[model samples]
Target: MKFAATVRAAALCTAVALLPATTAGYAQVEARVSPEFARLFATYQRIKTSYVDQVDDEALIRGAIDGMLASLDPHSSYLDGTALQRLNTMIDGNYQGLGISVQMEDGAVKVISPFRGSPAEQAGVAAGDYITHIDGRLIYGLEIDQAVEQMRGPAGSAIELTIFRPGRDNSFDVTVTRGVIELEPVTSELIDGNIGHIMVNEFSADVGSDVRNALRDLQGQATGRLTGLVLDLRRNPGGSLDEAVALSDLFLSDGQIVSQRGRNRQDTIVYESETVYRGDVAEGLPIIVLIDEGSASASEIVAGALQDHHRALVMGERSFGKGSVQTLLPLTRDSALKLTTARYYTPSGRSVQEGGIEPDIRVPQLSDPDAERRQRLAMRESDLRGHLVNEAGVQDEALERDRLDDPRFQLTAAQLEEQGVTDFQLDYAVRTLRRTAGTVASR
Candidate 1:
């Protein structure tokens, strides 16, 4: 079966959300009617009865629900109809469209990242690009789901996107042909000196098993025994939390992978290794994890776990800092609430809220001409309006570290291109692995 089908099958058998359903009955809790609630009801009544323009009850109700969640955090939202379907589409890991993870930023559709090897990426859709129009239609005030639905269509269909890139002088148009985006969560190749390079594009269904199989396949393709490994999570907007734990368990024999703490006691839970996978699949291999500003949620979980355990040397820029656990609370068969329930922490008890996973080795991608400019303009969790403050009292200055210039990474995109270096960070990682392998062999 396809991975998407596998996810649906798993969803049917287990709780739809990452956490189990609460057993406590509502009758057991004390009920209190506050004055604020009375005010809300009064306002609702006024809106229903005396509004200048007639607004449907459904729209008004949904708006009230959305407003309540909007005040809490950026991740929490009321999912129904197209929104719920989009969420399911992400979990399914395949869709016929220009592959991109997008979010509404101030009523504009902002590209989080173009999926690696997808038509959007090939067509030059970039992270932080504002999608202003789809096929000449203004998407300024449209819901994110509505805009995304307009973008997605049958395979082989062409769509024109008007993009407003931050660094560019003027808005541009890009026509891209939609294709079947089969999300291969894990892809690996045997690099020079028998170093296995695995790029995890997303955390989808059976990703842990897929990664394990990829490692085995890479090992088989190697001329000699694999000396090292590079796990790339760059530009990966995370998915299923179950798969995150499972993937981390594949590399860690024992110890806490991640912990979630919430207002409720039931939400406080810890996940450990050696539960999903028996032992480290790549035992004794020097591993490096690559992360960047786009790597979030589940990606942060895996990176933070391995880094805290000293199992892998994390490299690249700081992560997207989305540490909150979003629970899918189904209100009905056709609707659900994507609510932010808990905050996740690394093994060392580091909260990944505003403060993301800091890499052990900081490596910058110098190959992209707009890398520096984009880094400065990139929107992170902390930058989002109404974002939850870090419990550990992280300062705004810490999150603004990306704005500082690094002396080590002075190479321009033109210089790198002249030297035939497409991906500077990956190239540096590969070379580092080779050097480590040589040193190990000498011993």
Candidate 2:
């Protein structure tokens, strides 16, 4: 769930070859295929002829292409058939399935997150849970796409998943009914003390407009006056880059929002405030952005912009650092290439490639019993096999450490429930905002 772009009409061809030869003035340059290509063809011929069993030409070629892209980076890959369809569905914001984001980790299907209000979440599927069986069939060695395919079926259909939670002693089974997942990109509520809590689930189309409308609705619902705001972005794997810029523009009046640079100079682009929207929509309300390890791509973009501009106080853990931009280049009618094209920088010129947008105040989700263990096993951009390195050379060890065992956060999940606090992060943020509601100063 990252940003994607359509292919441009024109491409710049500025590559030039230089050669040094016996003649000092000018040397002729020859253009030919590299010897590695010959080796690849040789391997393909060997696989076709000398293999014990007959091999399909298409499969071999596809494997070669996949291998080539895999060597470059994790994000660059071939998208065809179901993969292409899934990408389109996510951007369009609706599908029929048990909505959960998963990945292949060590040949096991690991759950990244269950979308809020989705069937999987309602069925008790949590992050860090591993799906070992589907419909009573073992699926340990299946590909992630294959597992996802099995989990998705017609709406109202029931699917049984065997989940192995890390902290639990034994695996458990849960039957989840697949339903039409109409993803609400933005959701809002007027909490106690007249604080507006806006949860941005994803950066899909019209997210900025939805958030703007949500703010209006919350303002209308407040009894006295709108005290403060909480922009909840936790577990929001990102989408549309344009939407991220638009969302940031709602709070920033001037200055650069984000900038991206690629190999070609033409690909270098800068997004500034007032280009998407006019001015600050909050009207100087104290705001807090909640992020976690699941907040990625577009989420980081908005967080970085707001934090850099001093427009909001960012709380929660460091984000899932993914600063590169992926552009979807169509190869055929039903196929495309999701290739990493550029690295984006924050308004302060900080590249959150490996080191994500660090919160101004680190806050842990004390309501979840397994939050401590999950944080230790969480994966970030730096954990990927072939991730792009930040040119600024950030060291993860230098970043602020987690406060999982903080003395101030001694209340257990059971204790928090007894106190009627479901989400400690949002509760803490709301209280913090109430202390400085009308006195908040913005740059």
Candidate 3:
């Protein structure tokens, strides 16, 4: 009831603020109570008084709150209890589970992506898989928290999942052995030709520091000067905003990294380089940033900044396009409103709302046989119902083209695997870097 009252008050305040300053507009706003508000209150009263089954006050309030946020956008939501705890755990960068990021879609659990090097990924679980059942129990219509809880267990425990892949003709079951999902936010290795490879799993706390350390480690492994650097952000659903800015700052000497704009003037803010770390860490080294459909939010921020600055060549598929900033407004001791406070922009003022970061080089993952089919079924921010519109006004044709198959990519996952290519994208990036190094050496 208290939550409903707060919602009503907030709605009223928003309506009043939108009213024109003219006397007629003021009179019209004050004279008639909002019909929508009245209808909502009436419905609430009817449900409370005349429902056949008794409904708890907390359930009613929470439902009301969820409905309100759901109407705003896909990313906005009500967070409390397990959901809140999970968010904290993600930012902390460790959990005991299958290490997959998921969301509820139409009452079914949808896999966003499995964490890099996790058991789920090793078992071939992929993005765009719909999880229908957990173990032997039907999990449809269950809360996301409940479904997530079912997936989590002690390390080494096994869980069976019934996955409905959009491209597949029939559903299949996958058994994964859970483990201590210790998220190594940044990892680096020296590849052939002294190329440095760094993979950023997530932008958690101290991610900038972790990346810096990774760079140092890779440099140590190299026999001579590092010829190039590959910064991998594939399957990285973003985390801390500050860490994004911090990581971007590592590649830029100066200029704006990213900017956030909200309805209120006070909410607009710009983040610049040279504010976190100093000059570019890999200065003068050809840098390639690898991203895909799973790379989102903070990942986009880093990629967008580096791409816009011409500091890095962004390769792979388009990013996940989650540019909206969610400010956690505390409601109670354990609960908060994960409200969409602002939309972020790249240095060139491009909004990443629906149109995600387009790669400088559109390299398809030739390794996966299902890549083409999955791309067609993959859900981006643009596919989400009630998603925010880009202020620049995007053409529907552009969004449609993203799913169209390119004749250039024809290799199957099995074919590539047989050729000793575990990851086509990374291999392509390394080859590209090697070629670039050759050109520089010849010059």
Task: Write the candidate numbers in order of decreasing TM-score.
Answer: 2, 1, 3
Instruction: Give the lowest summed-lDDT range of ten residues in model 3.
Output: 1-10
Which regions of candidate 3 deviate over 4 angstroms? 1-36, 404-408, 438-443
Q: Write model 2 residue lDDT over 134-177, tens digit each, in one string.
A: 99999997866688899989999999999998766689999999
Q: Spell out the clash pairs found in candidate 3.
A: 367-413
- Number of the top TM-score candidate: 2
TM-score of 2: 0.90
Off by over 4 Å in 2: 1-32, 166-171, 441-443
Tens digits of per-residue lDDT for model 1 on 1-443? 00112222335334333222121221122124345555656676687689998877567667877888878888888878877886777778778999999888888898887899999999989877899999998999887778988999999999999999877788999999999998888888888789999999998888999999999999999997898888999989898788999999999998999998988787588999999999999888888899998898899999999998888888898888888987776666787777777888999999999888888877888998877777778888887888888989988787777677878889888998999899998988888888887342111
Stretches of candidate 1 above 4 Å error?
1-32, 438-443
CA lDDT, every prediction?
0.83, 0.83, 0.82
- Residue 264, model 1: lDDT of 76
Clashing pairs in 2: none
